[model samples]
Target chain A: MAQVRNKQVLLKNYVIGFPKESDMEIVEGSITLKVPEGSSDVVLLKNLYLSCDPYMRLLMYKDTPVSLGFHYSPGSPLTAFGVSKVVESGDPNYKKDDLVWGVTKWEEYSLVPSAQILFKIDHTDVPLSYYTGILGMPGITAYGGFFELGCPKKGEKVFVSAASGAVGQLVGQFAKLTGCYVVGSAGSQEKVDILKNKLGFDEAFNYKEESNLDAALKRYFPEGIDIYFENVGGKTLDAVLLNMRSHGRIPVCGMISQYNLSQAEGVTNMAYLIYKEIKMQGFIVSQFYPLYPKFLEFILPHIREGKIAYVEDIVEGLESGPAALVGLFSGQNFGKKVLAIAPQ
Target chain B: MAQVRNKQVLLKNYVIGFPKESDMEIVEGSITLKVPEGSSDVVLLKNLYLSCDPYMRLLMYKDTPVSLGFHYSPGSPLTAFGVSKVVESGDPNYKKDDLVWGVTKWEEYSLVPSAQILFKIDHTDVPLSYYTGILGMPGITAYGGFFELGCPKKGEKVFVSAASGAVGQLVGQFAKLTGCYVVGSAGSQEKVDILKNKLGFDEAFNYKEESNLDAALKRYFPEGIDIYFENVGGKTLDAVLLNMRSHGRIPVCGMISQYNLSQAEGVTNMAYLIYKEIKMQGFIVSQFYPLYPKFLEFILPHIREGKIAYVEDIVEGLESGPAALVGLFSGQNFGKKVLAIAPQ
Candidate 1:
């Protein structure tokens, strides 16, 4: 077997606080372009696009919780959900030339188990990059969390935090699609503009400009919020708790604001949880993967008709992966941040 | 109509921080012996037992949330769940000399709306004082919160905070009745002893003595907690979050520790909700009232068989109501705290 040059991003050390680009290094490695002989569940993949998410930060620690499933140690390639093509296969489920998206190594080529392949790419009419974002993990996260957990009713008030990010943007649109009155908050004015004008949100605000988030939320939701899609926890969650109506639901998808802190900020207004009879639950995308087919059946027509829109912040080359992933912590990415390495 | 001297506990003023006996005062007032004429929903009651609860502290605030209902303005008798005998009735549902337990004013005689009566007292085999604790609002609170919200399975590890309080004591007993491995935490060693020896808890601990609450929880629940009945919020709740198993449930019934704080203590470990895939819900007892019949059927047998036991700390006379209610904030009451104004 011959070897080819494989550029990879490797974890240099365990990250304690805010992750910087220096925490990861781009290294040139090599891989054989074929699967190991007789391996029942292995496949070789050509990495196409990689996703940058807030939860990725949790896997960088020295000791992660068992439930998080995958974590990387020092001196090894980082792993993430990526859009890839099957180059060689030993698994009956996947074959050469098949396009797929799931967990893969942050390298030019990866040999992984077939179980990690969440779903094969079946629809090709939309942007193939969509599988890396709105049609993939983030999509299912917004769909299952909002519809299944939120249980939103028509004409109800809905609020989304980090509204311009991968999951938040889609949650806002889904709320609107369900006949809800939607309001979203983002870190910057540009993202706020995109949420209100482009994504069909009823209203949007630049949270950075608001001195009091509680007052800002009151201004947006005068009667009180019915469903709070909690993407950023900490003070944002506390403010939303105060504004939530009786019997409100909070589907906690991510807590981007607290992910990097050594000591998380305390949520003080939780007493409202009892007074208002609120339900707050936290979940990850994998728990909702069973809803993929139903999600596709509901989303595909809307995508083709341009009724539901999506945004992507694409950074080119394998070397730029570190900066793109780091940008997520600072709210630097305008939308779904993806690292594009190879063409289909 | 003849009037009788009605001794009452009235709110002196709105309370801010920790409540003192001075925040309430005994006042001698008078009430007519008959219900208001032609008022179809009005009932006259001879008040007997008044219960002290953590949620009552919220009603004393100048601006209570609207969902809480029935806030007492200054110069008015404080309202609480009590056992009473109806002296006169204008509603078709009740007749003179009927026994009932529900929300009633803190006075020797109360003229209240018929809707305030939660249920008629039908069982007299148990101590009537149980109506103010186990068989009344707190009873409904414990049964509904534990079985309905906690969702305990047989042999699951269960933890309860404020284990010696009226609601916590019953929740622990209910968890054990379901065949769960139960652990409870209280502020004092005496309460801890009562939990393990009298209430049938598998293990108990004094949370105040253990400087590190997280370590204490690990010691008791070695396999991690499957259910946590949260009665006291702040540090205990934060500590409990760190020890929860994946998909654990937290039924939040009260936040006694937070009631007296001008600014509530921050709960920092909420991010565990996501990592553990936890479902945390806050609910008042009234939301589960529809399940009262089922609760009564299940618990009546246990009480008859002596499988469940309860403790009460009774303070005599309406004048002592202030001290008994204030004692709750300082963990001064050993078990369920009740005020006895008159003999049935």
Candidate 2:
């Protein structure tokens, strides 16, 4: 076994409010480039791309009840989903130099338990960094939340909030594939333009510029929304509630807007659920992972044929990780934010 | 044709804010004793009993976007579901003196269209007024909202707001019948007693007495609520959001507390839906009407066997109707409120 320098991002302390760059410290440490002897279920990996997801903000809070089966502690490297290449393996499923994507730490080299690896990377024709985004968690999130929970019918009206982000962009495209009239709301005019001109959304509006979200939603969905993929909660959810048609479906994927708030905003229009016979359901993408093979089979062709497009906002080095992660809460990331550490 | 005096409850004007008894006026109108000569689809009915349900308050609002298929106009009679005697009928479904329950006016005599009649009273073993409460619309509302939407499994923890009200009482009973641990909340100590001691609820609490609804819910459902049958929304609903178990289901029937408010209270705990992967659905009982016969088959036996019981707060005459209807908003009614006009 040999020691190598492992540059890591570690949580300095528990975050109380909006996180700043100072909350996380980039530390250089050494690690043996091998799994511990007799640890048959451990594999050593060189972390490639680390995904900066809105869900990571939740982990920074002290004793946050909600967890995605992972927890972060002060003085330890923060763990997240990433694309990595195996440096050594004690498990037969993976070998040295094998590419994979799964839950890994925000460091140069990680000794991950074999069970923590989500999948062996089989397709590499496209950008391997995609494993941290469009080809990974966010992709499955859009598929499960939209198709499974949303159940959009042809010609139905669809609305997506935070539509330029990792999950929302794909959801809009999927809605269009179902022949729905899709409209999306993003914080910036640039993101709104990408939703309309690039993603093929029928209409896109900058939510930040809209004084009255309800009126804006009403204008976009004159006939009322049949499906709403709720990403940014709070005011956006309240507005969408009023615009939902009879038997409308709302699949709540993420509420990034509410995540960092001291006190989450109140939604006053929830009574609309009964008036319109609406179904508002919330789900985690991991619950639908069994469908990943089929998801890949479904989305791969669209990607190759140019029917579907994905965007990633990549930042280099592990040291840039904290800022990239923090930027997600402020709508600073243009698309999927990925920290490229050891890019393949 | 002979003309008869018809005493009716007429709306003085469309209501604003909390409805007051003064908003309705008692008027003596006249109706023909017989169905119109060539009006084959018409049926003249002598009104028997009128049900005072929470949903009726929604119709009192001026130009409410949602309605139960009928409206109340100023100086005209208010319409509601009532049991009546078919004095004269041109439709073959009924003959003179046939007993029925359906949408009828708040009056001594009502000339109703045949299509508006809901059902011909078949089982005479139960009280005819039961047609207005346990055996009629509210019956189906509780059945549909709880069994269909709540989807309680054995040993699941269930919570019902408006516990001793028409629908909530029945929902608690149904949850208990399904082998679930059921808790209920009401406005007064008496209603809470009726819930735990008489209705077979595992525990009951007076919501009005509980300063911290979240703490109250935690005390009763320490393991967390698996199903919440939402009747009284607002604060109770907000609190329930924090105490829900993963994959919890909230079936929205009516938000009585919210309907009267100029500005409905905001629910700030909606983010829990995503964290817990909960399903909060709103529905009208009409969607479950097709399952009515099966519902009757399931409940009637329990009622006959003394395994299930229903309580009603009855007031005499159409004159007491306005007061009784207004009382529901204040939690003045003990159980299901019914106005007995002409008893069978």
Candidate 3:
């Protein structure tokens, strides 16, 4: 078989503090796109759309001491939850021309172990890039974190920080769908408008405009918040603690604000957790992978019926991967950020 | 009935930082030792053993903003969870000479609402003073925070902070009773001895002696803590977050360390909650009152079988109340500090 030129995104160094585009480099590589003879463990994939998430910054570390997910090595191609098509399959579960989504390398082609293929993309009626986000990890993350961990009740006042981002937008919409009064906080008025007008949030505010987050929360939730879907942690979490009602729930999905900082901000209002009898729980998408099928059943219909809105901030080419990934920390992207390495 | 002398403890002023003995004043007042005319909702209580709890400091504030508890006024008698004897009652639930434990004033005589009486002392086989320590509000707090919230399985690794304090002592024993491996951290070597030698904990350490709390926790909970019954929060909680296993639970019973500081220590390791899929919940004793009967059924048997041991630091006379209550913040008491106001 003739080898093909493969363009890839590689981690140039172990990141400390905020990640930069220079931290990851685009380089030329070569690969033979074929499954080895007599192999029944791995599948060869053609990477299409790659997810740019806040959690990816953790993997940029040398050892990734805190993360439960696999670490990205300095010399290797960055690994991410991606939408791919199987070019050749050595496993019974996968076949040639089958669409799938899972952990794939940031290259034109990925020869990943079949176990990393989380789900065979069974439904193709939606956009293929949706598999990288809304129908994939971020979708399951919002679903499981909001519904499973939060246990939000009808008419409950819910607050979401980073409410215009990937998981936050979906979470806000989900809360509203569950009959909750959802309020979200975003960095820009543009993002806030999308959250309130497009994503169906009952109320949305630019956190940057508000001098006091506590006062902003009090204005939205005079009776106190019953659930807070936490994405951007640190001070937002502290302020949320003060405005939480008795027996409120805080589902901590991501700490985007703290990820880039050398020393994450200290949350001072933890005493409110005791005073308000709050249950603050943390969750990841992989933990909720078992519920993906059930999630698809609930979400696919909503997406089809135009009842749920999914916004994607996508840029073309593997060369754009590093900048798109770094942009997540700086809030440069508007919605569910994705790198379009190749088109369907 | 003749008017009787009531030596009461009153808040001298609104406390801003660490409480001082001067913050409280013990003065002689008079009370008509009776339930009063046609008072069907009140009880005349002769306060016996008044508990010196850390939660009391929050009540001492002019108007407690963070506490879900009633605030104490400067000129009035300080209220606390106390073991009392009913001298006169108009409620059907209580009777004359009935021994009970509930919220009562720091006085020789307290005219409390009958509804404030939490439990009648039916299990008199044990010391009546246990009502102020092992069988009182602290007891219910330990039980609910540990068993109900922690959900410990057999052979699970458990860690309790403030191991020799009122609630922590019982939590450690309860973990042992549930067949879990328990380690405790306290401020003194004396407390460590009581935890290891007397209370049946697997291991105990003096937290004050350790320069690095994270290293100390790692040395004890090398396998990572499954359940952390959080008593003293702040730095200890931040360290515990580093040592917690996947899906670990932290039941925040109290944040005694943060209570005295005008500005509570900032907890910075909150990102660990998402990384490790941890659940850190906070609960108050009042929420668990409905399960009091079931709690007594479980606890009374353990107390009778000598499987559980409770320690109390009892001081005599009403005048000593101010100093004893103030001592809790300074780590001046070794066990559950109680003021023995009057004999049974």
TM-score, one value per model:
0.99, 0.98, 0.98
Candidate 1, superposed: residue stretches over 4 Å from native? none
Q: State which candidate has the highest DockQ.
A: 2
Encode model 2's per-residue lDDT on B259-289: one tens digit a residue: 9888889899998999999999999877887
- The 0-to-1 C-alpha lDDT of every candidate, in the order given, reads 0.91, 0.91, 0.90
| Lowest lDDT block of 10, candidate 2 chain B | B63-72
Interface RMSD per candidate: 1.3, 1.0, 1.4
Candidate 3 chain A weakest ten by summed lDDT: A61-70
TM-score of chain A of 3: 0.98
What DockQ does candidate 1 score?
0.76
- Scored against the true structure, residue B310 in model 3 reaches a CA lDDT of 94
Fraction of the reference Cα-Cα interface contacts (below 8 Å) that each candidate reproduces = 0.78, 0.79, 0.82
Q: Count the backbone clashes (under 3 Å) in each candidate.
A: 0, 0, 0
Q: What range of 10 consecutive residues in model 1 chain B has the weakest lDDT sum?
A: B63-72
Question: What's the TM for chain B in candidate 1?
Answer: 0.98
